[model samples]
Target: MSTLSHDERASLADALSRVLARQYGFASGRRQNLAIAPEQLPPIWSTLSELGLHAVMVSPDFGGFGGGADEIQLVQRQFGRSLLVAPWFQVAICAHAVARAGSPTQQGALLPPLSDGRAVMVLADRDAVELDAEPKVTQAHDTARGWRLEGRKTAVLHAGLATHYLVPAVTPNGGTGLFVVDSSAVGIGCHLSRLVDGSWSGDLRFESVDAQPLEGLSLQHHGEVYRSTEALAIAGVTADALGACEAALEMTVQHLRTRKQFGQSLGDYQALRHRVAEMYIELEQVKSACDLAAEAVEGVDSVQPTRGTAQALLVMSQSATWILQQAIQLHGGMGMTDEVAVGHCYRRMLVLNARWGDTREALARLRGDGMTKEMPGVAGS
Candidate 1:
């Protein structure tokens, strides 16, 4: 699908903002803690579905709105502003993957429910890790009954609320395969955990669990998909950081304008002005990086979109940390207080920076790209 014009995107953004204001109130620390309130999800899901946001990622052939990466990013940015905590991202990505890889029957069965928000899905990709080592997935296979799933997945966001999970597992031949597992399937288990942002997470266990192998879907192509997913996630997270930064900056600016120090308004101080100016510069840089990364994934070569995404992720991670720190410092001790929204945004940014892959991981991916020759058909080539 072609990209939406800036004005069209802005109209969607405005509508989303209005809905969020009415439904979620302001972005505050208190609201952050209440992210997954059971009572809030159904309505949120229905609202998004009605807005056609749920169908944005699905292809038109599947009776969806047929949106591409850019449209998805736009919606996610709005979601970030409210710190919206629905299972939409998980469901969208999984739906996209299934549409790309699943059999005709599977697509027909999954797409409609997902497009209408009647069901929720998550990607269970986390794996066990040895001390000081990279995480790896355990095998999940059973020759009997043509079923196999033997592994533990960690940090599965929204797992508790999801009806289905798309798990990436290693086949006996060492190839990766995606499997659709119903949450209610016997032998499947979950341990609920809390994220730094107060979102719901779980340690999922599949002990000889039955899974319908997603035929034709190969793990070999996942590198690009993984990178794209990370890029998309970083884009949304950067939006969250931007929202938090805006809130913090606004609060700080108001205080400076009204609060007097040494018989003068804090805004009149040269030092305070410089700090605010620095924050604005950093925010703009971060915003540009995010937009570029989003565009790169949508239009650039599929062989290595991660290169651009990694760059964006690094900038976003650093900018978020810097903005949060500056905002907190400017707010004094009250910034750390539970009553302050800055503290919550600060915490959320920290969590988002570490999710999918942290800054260190992103840097490694970026540097690793330098060792390889450019592939044919890439934008730069």
Candidate 2:
């Protein structure tokens, strides 16, 4: 994974901001229906594709910019801020997994479409989104053609729009094997559902669905690949949460400055001002945690990558949730309604917090990994 230079980062951020501003305002986003059919791609998806945003995760070998976690943060943060609804998050996760683990032939076959936005693939992990929730849903059995997958994966992001699904299944040997299944394959059932944030996901039921291993990959190395990919997924969502928190705080401050109480602006009140400042401090903390998490996923930092991401998920989930809640409270009655942006922001944060691994799950992972010692300023009492 290659890190981008400061100049490249700035250039990419500026371009994304300009495009998102013109194409994805709150009003426009509000017009987007929560239920998107599998065959119907959003118009904005084509625009983003034209901008080559999808290429951020693919390697240069496959006609992409060869970006790592840093680039993903830049793109996803903007997605979070505008509450953009698309399958980019799923693409980032899937692309990173393939780039890190797939063989050359596999990369050649998959990477080009992925980077150019021609394909949408999602990871279907039983415990990927929720941690240790229930009985394992899916298992892969070896077949002459390749494999057969039987079970279900629920609440898969952009599953409706996916061309393929990357499923991790339990092999007979008790190790995880990653497989690719076409969304239109026989015996595959996809039931679309709207998420709280107006995005869509699918409940996938695989009944003897034909599948192939993620091409020439060694199962012995699967554990490391899975861990790193999970770390990246956490880091990616944390970046989105950071963006959402920033937007929520900004919306709150704007409301306070304009909305009046007893003919005095709400921002004029000393108590309210202090609360906004606290929110600002929390936002900064989230920013730091987000950066470190990205670095950890990229293996550019001293912190153990997987453990670092788990820690980040915990910290950001708490701070981001608090920031959004404060935003809603500051807005008074209007905040509770979907008519305003803060409510939407809060809902978005809730979804992000729950995804990947929520605060409680992250904490459990940290404790399980023996990371109980509190860092001096990082993990406060």
Candidate 3:
């Protein structure tokens, strides 16, 4: 199916804004946190599911809305504005991976529940643990009766809430394989932790945990699956960062117009005005980069667009952090307070900076020759 047109996206964004305003009153100076209590999730889940948002990444045949990177990005931006705490990113990315990699039987079993919002799935990739030197899964194997998983997966988002987890593990033969593990199984326990943005993560322990091998699923050929997952995350989180930056910029602009100093509005001062103008310019740059990244992901075949995608993410991360910091400084001490939405947006930007890959990592990947080898036409010398 074709991607949504600009008009469709704008309509969807408007509808989402109405839903968010009615449900959370987010734009009314209300500070929403990332830590969501169990009781707070069901209603929001119902709303998003009813709106066909949760199924955006799944294919149409699998009972989904049949969306691509652009649609997912639009929903994520709205989610960011609302400060939603659901496992949306996890579920969407994992569902895409499964649809691309899993066997027909596996897809039949997993995609419907995910599309309907009856269950959630998380990616159990431990690459983040290497950064923190935390416990991470080192191996996986197949037993006579079933698959056995032995590894420590750390910083799994929404692990406590998901019914199952899609884990990437190194097999004995040294190939990477995907395994599905039931969260309620014996030997599977979640150690919950708080992320810097106040969101929840978990350290998962599996000692010979029973798992079902993803038969017929392979990462071999094209390597598009992994790249697609990363591209989705970059595009999705960039939308979130855009929302936060826009919110902060709007708040700063409003404050400058009303807050008085020297018998005039703060916005009247040349120096402050210049700073606000700079913030606006930077925000626009980031938004443009986000759009470019989304387009690169949408038109993946001929372009070999990984470099452009990484560059977009790098620019977005840096610009977002800069804008938010300037916004905080402009708002004075109130920006540092928890009562302010700008402070929360700042925290969210920091979190998004580290998700998928940080600026340094994205740059390093872009500079490397590995990604360019396959996309020969676009490869940098």
**TM-score: which is higher, 1 or 2?**
2
Please report the candidate that would top lDDT against the real structure. Answer: 2
Model 2 TM-score (2 dp): 0.92
Model 3 local distance difference test score:
0.74
Whole-model alpha-carbon lDDT for candidate 2 = 0.78
Per TM-score, the best of the predicted structures is 2
Higher-lDDT candidate among 2 and 3? 2
| Backbone clashes under 3 angstroms, per model | 3, 0, 0
- Superior by lDDT: candidate 1 or candidate 2: 2
Residues 1-381, candidate 3, lDDT per residue (tens digit)?
435678977888898888877876543324343435522343567888887777878878798866777787788887776666678888998888788777899999999999988888888765334554433434677788678888677667777788889876666554566678888889886788766666767878888898876665453322355456657767888888888788788889998999997899988989999999899899888888788788777655434576778788888988888999999999999989877778888888877765555677667767774342212212211
Report every candidate's CA lDDT.
Answer: 0.70, 0.78, 0.74
* Model 2 lDDT tens row, 1-381: 554678988988998888888988887777864445645677788888888788888888887887777888888899899998888888887898898778888888898999888998888774222464444437778877768988877668878888999887776665666778888999998888777888877777888999887665676555456666667777788889988888888889899999998999999999999999999999988988798788787672234676788778888988899999999899999999878988998888877765566778788777763232111111111
lDDT preference between candidates 1 and 3, better one: 3
Worst 10 residues of 1 by lDDT: 371-380
Clashing pairs in 1: 140-149, 140-150, 142-148
